[model samples]
Every structure is written in C-alpha cells, then in structure tokens.
Target chain A: MTTSREIRLKSRPVGVPTADNFELASVELPPPGDGEIQVKNLYMSVDPYMRGRMTDRKSYVPPFELGKALQGGAVGEVTASNDPDFKVGDIVSSMFGWREAYNANPRALAAAGPMGGIMKLSTHGMPPQAFLGVAGMPGMTAYAGLLRVAALKEGDIVFVSAAAGAVGSVVCQIAKIKGHTVIGSAGGPEKVAFLKEIGVDHVIDYKATPDVTAELAKVAPKGIDVYFENVGGVHLEAALNAARPFGRFALCGMISQYNETGRPTGPANIIQAVGKSLRLEGFIVSNHYDLFPAFVRDMADWINSGKLTWKETVVEGVDRAPEAFIKLFSGENLGKMLVKL
Target chain B: MTTSREIRLKSRPVGVPTADNFELASVELPPPGDGEIQVKNLYMSVDPYMRGRMTDRKSYVPPFELGKALQGGAVGEVTASNDPDFKVGDIVSSMFGWREAYNANPRALAAAGPMGGIMKLSTHGMPPQAFLGVAGMPGMTAYAGLLRVAALKEGDIVFVSAAAGAVGSVVCQIAKIKGHTVIGSAGGPEKVAFLKEIGVDHVIDYKATPDVTAELAKVAPKGIDVYFENVGGVHLEAALNAARPFGRFALCGMISQYNETGRPTGPANIIQAVGKSLRLEGFIVSNHYDLFPAFVRDMADWINSGKLTWKETVVEGVDRAPEAFIKLFSGENLGKMLVKL
Candidate 1:
C-alpha cells in the first residue's frame, strides 16, 4: 500500500463555498495490477465546472461523492505500468484529480464512457501544467463552441463575457484571428488591458461601468452578430440587447450564477431571442471529443507562432485545493486556476 | 383604377388587441405599371408572430405602421400581368396582406430581399389557400425548426406545446413521421382529442393540469430528446424538466407571454439548461428559405399519401381580420387560422 494525500468534499455549500466545505485527507492506494498504470500527479485543475459536481443533484455529470476525493482534470507522470501501450515516465492527463498518486486501468475506466478516457499528453517542450490550461480543455472549449456551435463567420462582430478568463480569452483571440471584430467585457482595468493587448477591438470594464449594457452599446454601436455567454444574468441580458438580427450565442458557462442560494433570475429579456431570431445553445465539451486532435494542432501552431498566449494562477499543494477553487468564485484568479501536487 | 378594401392598424393594443386597434378602409389602387401585376386576394393569414409586428419595438421584422395596411402572408389570383413571368389568372403568394387587391412588381420586390419575394403557386394539386398554412410559412416553420434548428434524429422523442396550432401540429406529425414518439400539450380536451387523432403518442391538457412539469414528467417518464417550443413560460420550464441529457429545443414562439405589459418571468428554471446541456434556439422561418424546396417536396409527398392532414379556421370577410388574429391567443383556433376575403 502507498500513502497518498487528497482533497475531499466535506459538505455541499449553500452559497459561495467556505473552507469548511472541503477537507484534506491522507489515503492508501494499492499498486498497479495487470493492465493498470500508477501515476504521480504533477498538477490538478480547479475549474468553475467542478462546483456543479459538488452539488448533490442529477446533472449532465454525476455529483462528486461526499468524503471522497474530488475528481477533475490532472496531468501526471506514470511511475509504474502494466499496460503495453503505456510506460513509466510517460506524461498523461486524466479526470482522476485532487490526489497525489493513483493506480488506473484505462481500459477498465473506458467502460464508464467519455468521462473516463485518459489522454497521453505531448508537451512539445512546453511545461506539463500547460496541458491543464490553454493547450487543454479551455482551449478546445473556445474552438468548438465558436466554430462548431455558434458557426462563427468572418466580419461577424463577437461579444465575450469574462473576457480575460481561460475560455473567454481564447474566444476573443480566435474571433480576432478569424477576421472578426471582437468585443470583450472584464471585471477590472487590468483584465481590460490584457484583452486590448490580445487585439480585442472593443473592451468594457464591467466593474467600472454600472450599466454594462449601455457600455456595450457604446463600444459595439452597430450591434453584435455572435455572443459567447460566459456570465449569466446581467451579462446575458446585455448580450441579448446588443445582439443583432439572427445573432448566434454559444452558451459556454454561467460562472456568476453558479453559487446563488436560490434560483438566480434568468435574463429577463430572453424574449428578445424571439425578436432577434437568436440561437442560444448550451454545450458540454466532453461530448465533442472528436474535435480535440484538430484543436490541439491549430492551438500548438498559434502558440509556436507567438499568436496565442496563456495565463494561469496556480496554488501549490493538494491542501490548498479548496482555497484555489474558492478563489475562482471570488474573481481573484487572473485566468485558469490550478493546484500543484 | 380599382377600389381595394384593407385592414389598417388604428392604434397599438395595450394587452390583448381589441377592435379599437383595427380600422377597415377603402383605398384606390392605380393600374399595374410596366412590370407590375394586380392581385385579387382570396385568403389572408393572421398569425401569432404578426402580434410582434403590431408593437413599436425594433425587431427581426419591422413593426406595423399606424394608419397603414397590416402586412402578412396572402394567397390570391393575378387579375392583370404586365410582366412575362406572371400571367392573369395565375395563383401567387405574397407578404402583402389584409388588402383585397395589390399591385406588385416581382423583380422590384425580390430585390428588397428574402421577405419581399412573391412566390407564384402551382397549387401542387392542393388548394391554393394551403400555401398560407401547412404548405407555406407555418409548414416551413415546423419543417425547418424540427430538422434544421433542432437537428432532430430519427429516435428523438419530441414534446410540442400549442400542439394543435398550425406550426405545432406539423411539428408533431413530422416528428412522428421521422419515427419519433411525440408528446403534445394543448389547452383543452378538444385540442387534446385532435392531437390524439394526429397520432401524438402522449397528450397533455395543460389547462386542466396546474403543474405542467409534473404532467410532462408523468407522460415522458424517460425524458424527451427534443422540445418544439410554441408557448413559452410554463411549457419551456416543463420541457427543461423533462429533457434528457443533451436535449435540443427549437424555440418557435412564446404566444403565452406575447401580450404581457411587463417582462414576464423567463422560465425561472433556465439554469436547468446548463445542467442538461440543452440547446434553446429561436428562429424566424424567413431566415431558412434555402430549405424550402426540400420541405415542399417532402410535405407534398406526405399530403399525397394522406399521411398529413391540415385544418384551417377561416373567418369570412376582411373586416374580421382582427377577430381572427385575436382568436389565436384565446386558444379558440383548431389549427391554421385564416381570414377569407
């Protein structure tokens, strides 16, 4: 048996999660059996989506079991291997997160479906943690949601909320690279500046502007052709009002409303969808695994050419996983939030 | 010169439209010029969407101008043709409505764009009036919203609100034809009976059931793959509740909240969209004209095979246009509502 430390969900949160909601515990792990691999995790990803898994409700993904290690994306190195396809020292990524070491038989996990597959990472001389950030889920999300979901086109004016975060940053950059005018909304001047540096044509500092819709209207005077909805409520309403006829909205995530105590008020003006002939579609990226290889190819090219940039605010140690996750809701993290093992 | 009778918008209605908002007038029309043709109207369509045109809001389609003739789909016969394309006695469908006679230049109208294209009808061995309903805008709405907007698969079980109405009726039939189980929700026992006659697998009398979500869960215990939204609010919430993972919602209209003075609470449970990975897309049939030919071909085959049945609630005289339009919200119309002139 091997001793491994992990983060566990002690309790579900009522509103914004507190430190008490999570617990750090040491667990015992067995050695890799036949056809299995043992991994020593290098990094654990703490994302907004993990919050949903903490809630005890039936959703697209199952709720994280209480007192069990919270699962998420992790990049690791194989310490022991029994599978012929994998070897020791091979870098890989899997959804078995918040733990220091694990023994996994991938073929056995595959029976659980799409959520189970372990991906072998080709870093191409980049840091392993980069696989947990822009070169990973966030990057693929922006690409698939834009091209595949919204059906974005050239000359289209795109609006992105949470514009400096992981997915939003990539959305704005891709929209610009594809010959579309991009508008971004971030909470502060620092994020606003980052958006500008990345070539967003228009930027709105939503924290400074009490009325985001009015600010958006000023920046995007002609109206937006596509809206990438990352924040719900006011942000969604602003996008709806600013969307032109036949606008398409790719519903990625609604981070702002995730921890609300009661049912948050939806965009009151969603009826505008009817008047504008809007297509608002919500998608989970796991369903679109077929697009991953193409995404990685294009993203790697962009990074190599210095046309793309990635940001991360990483907290060290498994004990601090709760703090890192809590910081996401607080909006203190600059971009993708990660916890190091 | 010919004296033509038309229905004009006197004033915008506050809540539900009344006779005070409508005015019948006689206008003199000049002779058809070089390329123009004069048409004598036989049938005019009054639909729920026209209600949006009555208001002063800037929408996908322009609002109705006060003291001007209300425009919508109309089927008529050409009385005089100066253009080689159209001859006298030819049946044609145009978006110039509530008028007994209209002089139109086909080329000039087509240049104005998709909305202005006047389609000459072959009657396809069906009644010319069918062009305004099952075989025209509403029929196309169902076809496009189902196949294109929803991206429905063969095994998809579809839930349709306003199931006995024009668009909803066709949506149910098409879903059934595609080998999908269909659940239809209508306001009364009569409408419920009609849905049953149309081969809807399950029927919900929404008026009798206070909790539509419960009713839907009872009927569609396994959950639905697609929801064809006609009446919004409660129906949308119910569909959201009854939706399986990765369900598609083709949001055609929101007849229930159309006349609200204030912003009606938009499906309080819209957050369910994120959990379910639901796609809620609102589309105007006009934007999907590219699929019209295929839709017409399929619909013609269905009609010829006696697999498709169409019902029309026609009110006599152009003076009763407002009454016909008002009847739509009252749930009195059995199917496609029309006014005969």
Candidate 2:
C-alpha cells in the first residue's frame, strides 16, 4: 500500500471559499490491480471554474461533494502500470487532481469524465505542466471560443477580459498571431505589462481605470468586433458598450460574480445587444474537444515558430492547492495558477 | 398639387411618448417628377421598434429627425406614376408612414434603407395591410428569428415574450405550425386570451404573475429550449432563470426598457448563461431580408392552410398614429396596432 496526500472539500462555501473549507488528508492506495495504472501527479491546475463546483448547485459540471478528493486538470507521470495503454515514465493527463499520487483502473479513470479522459501526453519538447495550462483546457477554450463560438472574421478587433490569466493570455496571443488588433484588459500593472509583452495593441489596467467602458471606448474608438469574456459584471458592460454592430461575445466565464453572496447584476447595457445585433454565447471547453486536433496543429506551429508564450504561478505541494485557488479570486496569479507536487 | 397631413416630431419624449411630443403638420407636394410615384397611404404600422428611432441617437436605424414626418411601414396605392415599374392603382409598401399622401422619386424610395425596400404588395387574398403586419416586417422577423437566429431544432419547447403582439403572435403560431410546444407571455387578460386563441400551448399573463421566473418554471417544468425575447427587463431575467442547458434566446426587442430614464439593470442571473451553455443573440429583421422569399412562402402556405391567424387593433386616421404608438407601451393593443388612414 502507498499513502498519498490529497485535499478534500471540508465544507461548501457560501461566497468566497476559505482555507477552512478544505482539508488535506492521507489516502492509502494498494498497488495497481489488473488493468490499473498508478500515476504520481506532477502539476495540478486551479481554475476559476472550479469555484462553481465548490457550491452545492447543479451546473455544467457536477458539484464537488463534501469529504471527497477534489478533481481538476492534473498532469502526472505513470509510476506503475498493469495496463498496456500506459507504461512507466509516460506522462499522462487526467481529471484527478488535488492529490500527490493515485492508483486506479484505467477503465475507472477513463470514465472519470468532464474535460479530457485519461490520455498519455506528447510533450513535443514542451514542459509536462504546459498541458494543464497553455496547451490544455484553457488554451483550447480560447481557440474554440474565438474561432467557433464568436465566429471571428477578417479585420475583427478583439477585446479580452482577464488578459493576463490562463484563458485570456492564450486568447490575446492567438488573436495577435491571427493578425487581428487585440485589446486586453487586466486588473493590475503587472498584468498590463504582461499583456503589452504578448503584443496586445491596447492594454487597459482595469484596476487603475475609473471607468472601464470609457477606457475601452477611448482605446478602441471604432468599437470591438469580438469580446472574449472572462470576467463578468463591469467587464461585460464595458464589452457591450464598446462592441460594434454584429459584435460577438464569447461568454467563457464570469469570475467577477462567482463569489458574490447576492445575485450579481448583469451588464446594464445588455440592451445594446439588440440594436447592435450582438451574439453572446457561453461555451465549455469540454464540449469543444473536436477542435483539439486543429488546436494542437496550430499551437504546435505557433510554439515552434516562437510566436506563442505563456506564464505560470506555481504553488508547491498539494496542501497549498486551496491557497492557490483562493488567490485566483484576488487576482494574485498573473497567468495559470498551478500546484507543483 | 396634393396636400398631405403628417405627424412630425414636436419634441423628444423624456420617458414614455405622449401626444404633446407629436404635431400634425400639412405639406403640399407637386405632381410626380421624372421617375416619381404619387402614393395615397391606406394603412401605417405603429410598432414598438419605432420607439428606438424616436430617440436622437446612433443606432442600427438612423434616429427619427425632429420637425419631420415619422417614418414607418405603410401600404399605399400609387395614384400617379412616371416610373415604368409602377402603374396607376398598383399597391406598394414603403417606409413612408405617418402621412396621408406623398410624391417620392422611385430612386429615393428604393434607397429608403432599413427593413424591406420599396416593393409592390401581392396581397394574395390577405388584406393589403397584412403586408405591414403578419406578412411583412413582423412576420418575417418571427420566421427568421426562430428558424435562423434561434436555430429552432427538433423537440424545442419555445417561449415567446409579448406573445400576443404582432411579432410574438406570429412566432407563437409558426412554432405551433412546426409542431413545437410554445409558451406565450403577454400582459393583461385580453392579450392572454388572444394568445390562447392562436393555438399557443401555454399562456402566461405577465401582468398577473408576481414572479415571472417562478411562473415560467412552473409552466415549463421540464425547462424551455428556446426563448424569443421581444420584451426585455424581467422577461429576459425570467428566460435566463428558466432556460434549459443549450437553450437559445433570439433577442428581437426590449420594449420594457425602451422608455426607461435610467440605465436598466440586466438580468441578475445572466451568469447562468455560461453554466447552462445558453446562447442569447440579438438580431434586426432588416439584416435578414435574405430569408424573405422563404418567409413569404411559408407564411403564404400557413395563411392559405388556415394554420396561422392574426389580429390587429386599428386606430383611425393619420392623426391618431401617435396614440396608436403610445398604446403599445401600455399594453392596450391585443395584437398588431395599426393606423388606418
């Protein structure tokens, strides 16, 4: 038997989740049984969407149950394998995070569901942790949202909220690489600098700005054609206000309103959507797995050509996973917030 | 010479428009110039969307200018014509309403942008005024919004706001004709009865319901698949609250917020859009004239087969057009409100 440290949900959060809402625990796992593969997790992702799962409500992803090991995007190395599909030392990705190591049947892990199933990772000279960040769900989310949901067309001026975060960074870089003028909005000066470094044409420091809508209007005088929505509330209102006729908004996440105890007011200018013929579509990255092959191909080309880049804010150990997640709400992380085990 | 009595914008209304905001004026027009046609107005449409144009602001359609005749859908007979395309006594439709008679250059009338261009009406055993109501802009709006924008699919349970109004009534009947269960929402008992008379599966009197969201959830226990958003504010919020996963909202109009002095608060539960993967798209009927051929065909078939029916609240004369327009906001009209000249 092998003992692994894992974090479990101690209690459901009402508004903002605290460290007390989670508890680290030890789980004893027997050696890999028949058709089982043991994985030692290297890096675990802490995403804003996970906040939705912490609440006791039905959503696209099921609510995280109390007293269970929380699940998320994790990249792990195969330590022991009784299955032919996965071999020792092979890097694999699974929806089984919040743990240092786990021994499970390949069949059970395959049925783990939501996001990608258990699959061996092809590093392609990229770091294994990259799968959890830039080359993973967040990256795919930006790609599918911009290309499919938003139906990005030629000469589309794209505006992205949370431009320094995991999904937004990728969205910014992708829009830039596609030769479209990109406007990125982030909370702090550091994020603003990061957005400028990523070749964004216009960077709005939302924290510093008095009126986001005014700032956006000033920057994109002609109005934006596409809005990659990450933060909701004010950002959504700003996007609506700055959007040109027939602008499309990809409603990826609303991190700003996730922790509100009371129901958050939607964009006051949402009525503008009618006169402008705006299409606001919400999407899950999991629903867009079909775009993976194309995404991977484009990403590989961009990565090889040194046109694409990323950042990671790593928190060491599974014990600090909750801390890393909480930091996401405070806008502490510049890019992908990850727990390095 | 022809003397025409027309309604002109005296002053922009601060809130809901009133008779004081409008002034009846007389204009004398000479006989048809080269390529000009003289028209005698029969009926003019008074639609909710005209309220948007009344405001002096940049929008999809240009704002209605002050000290000018208010432009809208009107069916007229060409009394005199110098244009070879138009003959005497030929019925025509143009954006030349709120007046009794006028002489317009065929080129200028053809260039009269927004909605449908100037065209002769076939009438097809339907009333000539039906071209301005069910078979014209409102009817086509319902068809295009439902089939194309909302992408109404198999087994879609549709919910329509302003269900007894011109556009909404057509939407209710079209959905029913296509064999989809539809829930129609309208204010007042009269509108509710009108909805029921049109084969609407479920009728919701928004005036009587204290909580539209709860009422919607009650009626659609299994949840709604599509929402035709004609009335915004609380109706939009209710739709968001009651929408099922992957539900689509065709945002046609927002009459509830048209006259608001302050910026209207959007749906508080708009975040549910992301979790539910809902799509809310705003569209103008003018952009969808490409669907008109199919729309006219479908409407003709439905009208001929007696599968589709409509009602109109006709206010007599050009002078009463302002009163007819104001009645839309008060929900006094059971269906399409028109000005019979």
DockQ, all models: 0.54, 0.84
- Residue B285 alpha-carbon offset, candidate 2, angstroms: 0.9
Q: Say which docking band candidate 1 falls in.
A: medium
TM-score of each: 0.92, 0.98
Best by TM-score: 2
Q: A1-341, model 1: which lDDT tens digit per residue?
A: 88889989999988899999999999888888999999999999999988888889888788999998899999999998999878899999998889999999988887778666777878998889888888888888899988888889877899999989888999988888888999998888788888989999999988888998999899999999899888888888899899988888888888888899886776777788876788888888887779988998898888898988878888999999999999888777777888889
Residue pairs in collision within model 2 = none
Each candidate: fraction of true contacts kept? Answer: 0.59, 0.88
Q: How well does candidate 1 reproduce the true complex, by DockQ? A: 0.54
Q: List, residue by residue over A15-60, the lDDT tens digit for candidate 2.
A: 9999999999998989989999999999999999999999988788
Model 2 CA deviation exceeding 4 Å by range: A111-116, B111-117
Interface Cα RMSD, each model: 1.5, 0.9
